[model samples]
Target: MLDQFLWVIFPYLCVAIFIVGHIWRYRIDQFGWTAKSSEFIEKKQLMVGSILFHFAVIPVFLGHIVGLFIPAHWMSAIGVNEHIYHLGAVYVGGFFGIVMFVGMFLLTFRRINNKSVRKLSSASDMVVNFLLLFITFIGIYATLVTNNIVTDFDYRQSISVWTRGLVTFSPDASLMTDVPLTFQIHVLSAFLIFALWPATRLVHAWSLPFNYVGRSYIVYRKHKK
Candidate 1:
C-alpha cells in the first residue's frame, strides 16, 4: 500500500496539481508570470550564476526527457547498448550536474547573503532555490556515489519503465518498490517541485519570449541640438 501510494497515487496527484495550478495562476496572475530577475540588485553574481545555471539546466532537462521518455528498446534498436548508454550518462550527466550544482550554490548564496537581493526576494523564492539545490545535490550524489561506488543499479529498467507507465496511464507501482532509496527520494522530491512550480517564480520558465523573434527591431535617431 505504501509503495502504491508513493509510486502511483502521489505522482498522479502531483501531475494534476501541476497542470491545474498553472492554469489557475495564469488566469489570475498573468502579469506576475516573470522570473523576477535580480540582475539589477546584484549583477555580478547574478550574471555568473544565471549563465551557468541556465546553460547546464537546459541539457539536464533534455537528458531527463530522453532518459525517462525514450525507451531502452528504442536505444537498443539504434545500436546503443546498456554499457555505452551508462558510460555516457555517468560522465556527461555528472559533468553538467556538478556545473548546475555550482551555479545553484552561487545563486542561493547571493540570494541569502546579499542584502539587496534578499530584501527583494519573497519566501517562495528562497524555498524554490533551496529545493532546487537539494534536488541537484541528491542527483549528483546518486550519479557519482550511489549508482557508481555503492551499487550498480540501472534505473532505466525500473525507474524509466515506471515513469513511462505513469505518463501512459498505466503505472506499475511494483517497478519502483525495490529501487534504491536515493532514487525514490529524488523522484518524490522532483514531483514536489512540480507541484509547487506554478505558485513560485519557476512558472516563468514557461513564458519564453518568442515574440522577440518576429518583432521589429528598435531604431535610434540622433537628437536635435
Candidate 2:
C-alpha cells in the first residue's frame, strides 16, 4: 500500500517538477548576462570543497544505482551475491554519502555564518543548501536504519524493481509502501531535490567542464607602434 502510493505519486510529482523547474529557471541571456568577475577568487578553498563534494558523493550515487536499480534475479543470474552488493550500498555508498553530508553541511553553514559570505548570499541561496541538507540527512538515516525494518521484504529487491521502472519510464509504485516509512521519506526527499535542482546553484552540476577548467593563461606584452 505504502509502496504503491509512493510508486504512483512521488515519481510523477518529481519528474514533473524537475521538467517544469528547468523550463521555468533556465535562461539563455548570453548577450546581457553579466556579473563582476571576481578578482579575489579563492582557488584553494573552492577546490577543497569541490573535491569532497565530487569524490565522496559520486560513488554513493553510483552505488545507489547498482543497489536500487538492478533486479536481484538479474544479478544472481550473473552470479553476484546480492548481500555483497547491498553492503557496497551501505558502507561504500554510505561513506561517500556521509562525506557529501558533511561537506555540504560545512559549505552551507559557512555560507550562513561567515559575514562576508552571508552578506552576499540570498534567500534562494539558503533555500538551495537547506534542500541539500534535508535530502542528505534523510538519505543517511535511510541507509542506516533500513536493516531494522521487518526483515521479510528485502530493500534491495524493492529498490531494484522501482529503479528499473524509473529507467524504463514505467515507474513502479508497488515498492514504495512495502519497505518502511523511513524509506518513503528517502524517496520523497530524493524526488523533491530532483524537482528543486534547476532552481538552485545546483544547476552548476550541469555546467561541468567549462565551469571548473582550472587552466591559467600566460600573456606577453607586445608594444604596438
Candidate 3:
C-alpha cells in the first residue's frame, strides 16, 4: 500500500500538480516568473556557487537520464553489462555527486550568511535550498556507502524500470517495493522537488533567452559635422 502510494499515486500527483501549477502560475502571475536573482547583493559567493552548482548539475542530470530512462536490455545489447555499469555509476556518479553537494552547500551557506541576500530571501527560498541539500546529500550517500561500497545493488531492474514505466504512463508500484530505503527516499525527494518547482524560483527554468538570438543588433553611426 505504501509503495503503491509513493511510487504510483504520488508520482502522478506530482506530475499533475507540476503541470497545473505551472499553468496557473503563468496565467495569474506572468510578470513574476523570473528567478529573482540576488547577484547584485553579493557577486563573489554567487559566482562560486552558481558556477559550481550549474556546471556540476548538468552532468548529474544527464546521468540520471541515462540511468533511469535507458533500459538495462538496451545497455546489455551494447555490451554494457551490470558490472561495468555499476562501476561507472559508482565512480563517476560519486565524483559529480560530491561536486553538486558542495555547490549546493556553498549556495545555501551564501544565502543564509550574506546579510544582503538574506534580507531579500523568503521562507520559501530557504526551504527550497534546504530540500535540495537534503536530496543531494542523500543521493551521494546512497551512491557511495549504501550501493557502491557496501552492496552492488543494480537499481536498473527496480527503480529504473519503475521510473520508465511512469514515463510511459504505465506505472508499476510493486517494482519499487523491493528497492532500498535510501533509494526510495531519493526518489520521493525528487518528486517533492518537482512538485514545488512551479512555485519556486525554479519556474524560471521555463523562460528561454531567445530574444538575444533573433533581435536586431544596435548600430552606432558616427555623425560628421
Candidate 4:
C-alpha cells in the first residue's frame, strides 16, 4: 500500500497538479512568467553557473528520456547490451551529474552571498535551488559510488517499464517495490520538483519567445538636425 501510493497515486497527483497549476498561473499571472534572472546584479557568477548547469542538464534530461522511455529491448535490438549501456550510463551520467552539482552550488552560493541578488531572490528560488542540489547530489552518488562499487542495478527493466506504464495509464506499483532506496528517493524527489514547478520560476520554460522568429527587424533612422 505504501509503495502503491508512492509509485502510482503520487505520480498522477503531481502531474495533475502541475497541469492545472500551470493553466491557472498562465491565465491569472501571465506577466509573472519569467525565470526572474538576476544577471544584472551579478553577471559573472550567473554566466558561469547558468551556462554550465544548462549544458550539463541538457544531456541529463536526454539521458532520462532515453533511459526511462526507451525500453531495454530497444537498446538490445540496436546491439547495445546491458553491460555496455550501464557502463555508459555510469560514466557519462556521473560526469555531467558532478558538473551540474558544481554549477548549482555556485549559483546557490551566488544567490546567498551577493547582497543585491539575494535581496532580489524569492523564497521559491532558494527552495528550487536546494531541491536541485539535493537531487543532483543524490543522483551523482548513486551513479558514481553506489552503482559502481556496490550494486549496479539496471533500472531499465523495472523503473523504465513502470514509467512507461504510467504514461499509458497502466501504472504497476509493484515494479518499484524492489528498486533501490536511493533510486526511489530520486524518483520521488523528481515528482515533488515537478509538483512545485508551476509555482516557481520554472514556469518560464513554457513561455519561450518562439514568436520572435520570422518577424521583421526594427529599423532605426536619424532625423536631419
Candidate 5:
C-alpha cells in the first residue's frame, strides 16, 4: 500500500538524511558560526517571543507524556474524560501551535532579513521548519474537525513496545504501521524534528535558560597541583 510505503520511507529517509547531513554540516560548522544579527528593535517583542517558545514547550512535553505514557484509565480516574481530553488537546495544542508559529516565523524572518544570518540559513533548514509547521497545522485541524480518527486505544502500549525495540536497535516494523494517519504524521514530524535539532540554532533548547538570562555560572576552584 502507498500509505505503508510512505510510513516506512518517510522515517527511514529522515534518519539517513539526518545522519549524512549532520556529518557534512558538522564539518562545515567547525570553520565558523554563521548566524546573523537581531531583527527586533524592541526588547519587549524579543522577550515575548522567547516566552511564547518556552511556554508552548510545557504542554508539548505534557502531551507526549499523556499520549505515550499515561493510560486511559489513569486519565479517567483523574476525572478527565476522553472527549473532553481530546477537545482540550485541540485548543491547547492550537494555542501552542500559534505561539510556536509566531516565534519560529519571527526567528526565521530575522535570519532572512538580517544579512549575516541570511547567508547561513540554508534550504534544508527552512524545509525542516516548514515541515514541522505544516504537520502541526494538520494536527490542529485533525483535532478540531475530525471524529473516529484516533481509534487506537492501545497507543501507549504500542509506543512502549516500539521504543524498546528502537533502543535495542531491532525496531519492529509491524507496530509502526498501526498508528493512525493523524498520529503517523505527528510522530514522523516529531522524529524528523529531533533528527534536525542538533543541526540548527534549535540546539538552544538544550542550553540552560536561567544561565542564559541571569548569567548564572558555577565556578569551582581547582585543587593546587
Candidate 6:
C-alpha cells in the first residue's frame, strides 16, 4: 500500500500537476514567463555558474531520457552489453553530475551569500535553487557511491522498467520496492522538483525563443548629441 502510493500514485499526481500548472501559468501569467536572469546585476558569478550549469545539465537531461526511457533490451539489441553500458553511464554521467553539482553550488551560494542577488531573489527562487543543489548532490552520490562503489544494483532492470511502465500507464510499484535507499530518495526528490517546476522560474525552459531565428533585426536611428 505504501509502495503503491509512493511509486504509482505519487508519480502520476506530480505529472498531472506539472501539466496543469504549466498550462495555467502560461494562460494567466504570460508576461512572467521568463528566467528573470540576474546577469545584468552580477555578471561574473552568473556567467561562470550559468555556463557551467547549462552545459552540464543538457547532457545530464539527455542521459536521464536515455537511461529511464530506453529499455535495457534496446541497448542489448544494439550490441551494447550491460557492462559496457554501465561503464559509460557511470563515467560519463558521473563527470557531468559532478560538474552540475559545482555549478549548482556556485549558483546557490551566490543567491544566498551575495546580498545584492539575495535581495532580488524571491522565496521561490531561493527554494528552487537550493532544491536543485540538493537534488544534484544526491544524484552524484548515487552515481558514484551507490551505483559504483556499493552493491552492483542494476537499476535498468528495476528503476528503468518502473519508470517506463509509468509512461505507458502500467506502473509496477514492486519494482521500486527493493532498490537502494539513495535511488528512492533521488527519484522522490526529482518528482518534487517537477511538481514545483511550473510555479518557479524553471518554466522559462519551455519558452525557447525560436521566433528569433526568422524574425527581422532591429533598426536603430541616431539622435543628435
Q: Of the candidates shown, which would achieve the greatest lDDT relative to the real structure?
A: 6
lDDT ranking, high to low: 6, 1, 4, 3, 2, 5
Residue range 22-122, candidate 5, lDDT tens digits: 66666676443233224444345456655776677678677766766566678899999877877666677667767776765665555456565556567
What's the true lDDT of residue 174 in model 6?
96
lDDT of 6 by residue, 118-199 (tens): 9999999998998999999999899889876556688888999999899899999999999999999999999999999999
C-alpha positional error of residue 99 in candidate 6 after TM-score superposition, expressed in Å:
0.9
Deviation in angstroms for 152 in model 2? 3.5
Model 1, 1-225: lDDT tens digits are 988899999999999999999999999999999998878678998888888999999888988898998989899999998888888788999999999999999999999999989999999999999999999999988888889665657788899999999988999999987888888888999999999999999998887899999999999898999
lDDT tens readout by residue for model 3, 140-167: 9888888855465678888998898998
TM-score of 5: 0.62
Scored against the true structure, residue 171 in model 2 reaches a CA lDDT of 74
Estimated TM-score per prediction?
Answer: 0.92, 0.78, 0.90, 0.91, 0.62, 0.93
Top candidate on TM-score is 6
Give all candidates' CA lDDT scores.
Answer: 0.91, 0.69, 0.88, 0.90, 0.62, 0.92
**Could you give candidate 2's per-residue lDDT for residues 1-225 as a string of tens digits?**
655556766678778878877666665532222222122443344456556877787787777776776677778888777677667767877788888987787777666766766776667678877877887888888777666455565776676677777778777675555667777777777787787676566665654457446777668898999
Minimal lDDT window, size 10, model 6: 147-156
Clashing pairs in 3: none
Q: Could you tell me the lDDT of residue 184 within candidate 1?
A: 84
* Residue-wise C-alpha lDDT for candidate 4, range 1-225, written one tens digit per residue: 888899999999999999999999998988898998888689999999988898899899999999999998899999999889887798988888889999999999999999998899899999999999999998888777767555646788889999999999999999999888788889999999999999999898777688789788999898999
Score residue 40 of candidate 1 by CA lDDT. Answer: 69
Clash pairs, candidate 1, are none
Any runs in candidate 5 off by more than 4 Å, and if so which? 1-48, 113-117, 120-125, 146-180, 209-225
lDDT of 5 at 175: 80
